[model samples]
Target: MADDASFPAGSEILLLEDDLPLRKRLAAHLRLHGAEVTEALRLEEARRLLRDLRFDFAVVDLHLPDGEVLDLLREGAFSENTGVVVMTAFGGVKQAVEAMRLGAGDYLTKPFEPDQLGVAFSRCRWNRRATRRDEHRSAEPGAGAEELFFGQSLAAVRTQLDTIIAAERRLERRLPPVLIEGETGTGKSALARWLHQNGPRADRPFVSVNCAALPDTLAESELFGHERGAFTDAKRARIGLFEAADGGTLFLDEIASLSPGTQAKVLTAIEEGTIRRLGGTREVQVDARVVTASNRPLDDLVAQGSFREDLYHRLNLLRVVLAPLRDRGTDILPLAHHLLARIAARHRLRGLTITRDGEARLLAQTWRGNVRELAHEIERAVIFSPGPELDFATLGGAPIPSAGNWRNPAWRLPESGFSLETAVNEFIADALRETGNNVSAAARRLGVTREFLRYRLSGAKEPSAPPDANHPGG
Candidate 1:
């Protein structure tokens, strides 16, 4: 398995291609990039390789002699973490869409260059690797669901929540689909869980799905049941999440990440109160209340055509927006103490308190990760504390940007307003300088993708800042 933070290096790869020339070229390219390549010319050979060797990733040509390469995906031939990418000479929208629905991590058209292959490989390489176990461990029902501590800023939202509760009481059979929008780590999941525990369906089932972490393949069938023979490897008719959460609530977190196909199915299910198993024709009515949460704006996504407008409207029927921790001014210290008490109790400590310096640090710091980050920091402090008091000195710190250029520290405004593009260029240059001209390290600091950084660099005017071994990630 690959590390939590690096690319797929020294990982075993299974390459299946009927075109011998293409297969040989791709295998060599992968090996050159630090992969152990296992080549296969036919479906049978690929099956034998899959059976015999453990692989980190599989590159398969959709048009295999024995059958569709999708069969290998369906047959449970690859481990859960072993990502797969599909390639085809006869590429079309239908094929690509089908590949996505079938759970391939990425897709590529034929006659592509080694660079294109690497792009596809990269997609499957750094894909989010959180499993259901990690989900359960991270989202443990922290504190009680009944207790909600909100500052004065949340008065309006509190009223909205009360309205939801009232509506839930009146609507005996079904509830309106609720949507919660907030930044990451702003307690969206916790709020969703709270609603499930407090609502009329308190005794019923509650299913939570992290949309960002869902595998690309089998997403639709997983949400809306699937029949036995829905595809190659679905041996038994399985109840989808909707069915599993029947007469209860289904919470979908980071809902913006859902694909267009999955989004359509979800919209249909919500509007019609019916779900058809992937291969089955019969429509089964489900009484599950969908409460989706997104860290991004769904309206923007809808306008951009990435998200369906109908789905967005449906989800917005009952919407709640959560304020980020930074904006929740008075709640900072109290929230810190609340978390500290829980951590101390769990660790069997007599008493724990945050010192004055710790409180100031919490208030002054820009919590990029929000409440989730605070919780983790508090836990670390409790575990490693030599004594009871938690001091800010023990926690590490980073450089703070000046006030005038908080977002862009090194850039300054001249007497004449500078162009926005020029400002961005200078910011990139400053980042490179700070990191000593290392683009990857600078990208990490900038919180942008390497591709984004490189695009910025490439777009710069004449005298292009050439980046190679000397300026990495540039």
Candidate 2:
């Protein structure tokens, strides 16, 4: 028997091939790897199995006894969650492309080794994950794109994650749930993904969902799945994230936002290793490792009676708390540079560097939004700067002044005082010049209205009253 590490126990697979010898060989290989293989030698048999069962993956031959597998593909016989690998005797670019267009995750030509099935299955899993991720991003625009950066400040976090990964390797099944607590924009989702990718089940699907974004009415169905007639709009049966992430990790971001009832269901799923669909009576056993994250601490939510204490305790078994960005001052500079490099590559820019003053400004601000905010700041500078060095474009308010300049807050007035009007005019002019003389852009850089900027540029005599930078017609 092959090592069971390749497939989780109870992993369901539908194998369709006309050649009895090849079908038996593939089925034997899959069974040895811990998958429960449902063999079908004809298209009709495959169709019947697909109609009655939900498979994690499907291996289909292009030409079958009754019909071409492409016919089933065209009819959408497989769910979006099912990873399909199409095998063909006649290898052609057109056939491969058509299979892929019809939702095949991978294409394999004939005369391949049985060992190669593992690689093909891995690729199929990746394709399924990518498709789901793209669908999620489409629903939630402006999702975080910041890469995970573990620096000195995050050493503790890294160590804890390493320990968890080590533990996962030692276990054969049902990895314990992980709880990640952090402030918003602290890269909780990214951390969860990193844990999944580094864990023993890296080859399995990594499913992610934002509980906070799920409507209260549909939260249960979304997490546990639903039957065809589960609800008003549940026109068809659908496997939820738990089943989609079977034998892998399911990341639930902002888990505290789920209603008490849904929280109870989640707790049950964790404890029993099974979930009953919203309208389902039969409890479907699943082996997904749940990794939940919350911007607000679950302890607080439990205390407030908004979350279930039992669920909190269950997930609290393996917990890691991420420090806020303001508390991790040492990581600011290095993380910024890391993000800058990625952003520059994405924009196809060359030789982009943050100026010394820009570094000072980045370090000065208390990043309330954490790494996500830092990435945006760097991206803004990259997009707006015309030179090789970034000027921060207005990221940290006004520019830093020289040691002896009047702009310094600690600077005391000399025996000969400076003109207040001259100082304000110079400030406005500097903003205009920095933004390439665009009034609107300059106004934004100065945190003022365009009207205020225009009025300041008019060179009018100073009014007795203070100027209102926010006024519409300043």
Candidate 3:
């Protein structure tokens, strides 16, 4: 009887419908069920109420006189606690999919039951409440603080951040698990933490596990815990990361490396919210939000049979792809500055500023290591810079020409002043001539990947002017 719950007591609901009679009946039903109801007849009125109050629930009619209600989901007008239930008389499966993708918690057709309205909010609140309770029972204590952050950069990077922020605003019932894909050192783990901190369960614990770092022999026990004497080394009963993170978030970084056995077990926990400790008899239920990050393509891995398709489906509900630093356009210098300041503060050194030349060098180069590499460079620069200003040398390595110069030969500049990529390509071509087109000797002489050189030679983009402070991006 208790499991067949109706709604959370005193839950604040925003009900928007053009049909006044139907809206009133829905409001009356919700009010009678002990929910605080706010009614709006027009989209504009709903927009106004959303701006002023934080509601626990939102029941929106899809077609309004002004426009479709999908805009509200796109704009994130409602708070994160609001589980948007889109009701429509005209729309079908396509509309429902669109609503779900845009962050609706539930979708309903016209002539649906008031009790079915109750059903829409059930899984989310129940899981959320259960998670909260689990947090109280966690054996390991949680840190009471959370870090807050917002990121900005040039156009490409800016677009990426905007997409991430939009996804963060969605208040789905179960808080759809996120799959973050990016190159190594591109801040995949950092982005995962940001999502957890900004989400509805922010106040709860955030547990991070580096799947790649865990050894195959012990990863299962480490993740799912082990009862005393469950394995050769099990001396006492233990709690797994999932239980520790109940009611909060579990960030699995480098998740693509998880072995098949571990992957299967993790999928079970995600799908059923339950896990059995290694050597334990009973299954323990957990309610931790899952966020996974991978440096490689999980799809390719799945196709290769290295990963489970079912697990990938469960984890890839919402996606955030972090761009490599080199592709981020004009955001390079601003990020460098931010990193420099933080690095200086952390090291107890005087704040350091990047010189103009330093900025140019920073903007240039293939940052194969991405943001993490950049941070290390900044830290190194801080350690050696005598004055408050940092030069290119302090950042380490000679200033390399950007990919732009190689990709485009028409961009005008002094003879040798701006010919890094062009010069490198020319030298390689000349080497081929000098060696009579011997690719093996060319590769050996150049000490570079033959594939790498070939890619550059064939895949160069249209030439563009050097990056200017006025125009920045990857």
User: What TM-score would every model get versus the actual structure?
Assistant: 0.54, 0.62, 0.53
Residues 1-474 of candidate 2 have per-residue lDDT tens digits of 112324545668999988999989999988988788999889898888988887778998888768888899899888655778888876465786799998898888887888888777777765654555465557767645346899877887899999999998999588899999999988898899889878898777777888988999988877887866579997655667776677787889999989889998888888999988766656677788999999998898888988889999999999999887777754788998999999999999989998877876776778889888989888988888878898685865546655354243322343234588777788788877877888887776566676566667786543556556665432
- CA error at residue 93 for candidate 3, angstroms: 62
- Give all candidates' CA lDDT scores: 0.73, 0.79, 0.71
User: What lDDT score goes with residue 88 in model 1?
Assistant: 70
lDDT of 3 by residue, 1-474 (tens): 112346766777889999988898889899999888988878888889987775667999888888878888788775543578888785575887698787777788888888788877765454434443354336345423333222443244445545655665684334557798889988777777766666676677778777887889888876787655678876544567776676678888888888998999999988888888787656766677888999988888899999999999887766777767776655677788878777777788775688867876676557889887988887877877788888767445445445345332212333224448777788789768867977656655555555544655687652454323332111
Runs in model 2 with CA error above 4 Å?
1-146, 396-474
**Superposing every Cα of model 3 onto the true structure, what RMSD results?**
19.7
Report the number of the highest-lDDT candidate: 2
lDDT for 407 (candidate 2):
42
RMSD of each: 26.8, 13.6, 19.7
Q: Judged by TM-score relative to the true structure, which candidate is superior, 1 or 2?
A: 2
Q: Which residue window of length 10 is worst by lDDT in model 1?
A: 407-416
Candidate order by decreasing lDDT:
2, 1, 3
Q: Which stretches of candidate 1 lie over 4 Å from their true place?
A: 1-147, 395-474
Which should have the higher lDDT, number 2 or number 3? 2
lDDT comparing candidate 3 with the true structure: 0.71
lDDT of 2: 0.79
